[model samples]
Target: MRKLTDFISESFIWSVGITRPKPGQERLAALYITATLAASILAAMTMFLLVLHRL
Candidate 1:
């Protein structure tokens, strides 16, 4: 679980062209969380539409 979390955080940082956060920078973490939630919501909507179309 720790490895997965670290991998996701690293990937998000790399995608955004940023280095690891320095101390006291919480906004980066919040940005990552929001982005992840948005992506997940989009993925779920896509899957739902696909399934509905097939039915």
Candidate 2:
């Protein structure tokens, strides 16, 4: 379980093309990724609703 979380966070950081954070900073990196994903999803939903209302 622990290793899985580490791998996921590391993969996220790598995919984002950012430098590997220090050991203590992994949590913050994960939080930043989560916030970014959430914001993108929210923006897409808002845009979809606006377009749907035009019909």
Poorest 10 consecutive residues of model 1 by lDDT? 25-34
How many pairs in model 1 have backbone atoms within 3 A of each other, for residues 3 or more apart or on separate chains, i.e. clashes?
0
Off by over 4 Å in 1: 1-23
Residue 32, candidate 1: alpha-carbon lDDT: 68
Clash counts per candidate, in order, are 0, 0
Top model number, lDDT: 2
Look at candidate 2 and tell me the lDDT of residue 55: 69
Over 1-55, each residue of candidate 2 has an lDDT whose tens digit, in order, gives 4555566667777787778877798777666666677688999999999999986
In model 2, what is the error at residue 3, expressed in angstroms? 11
Q: At residue 31, what lDDT does model 2 achieve? A: 67
**Residue 3 of candidate 2: its Cα lDDT?**
58
lDDT, residue 28, model 2: 73
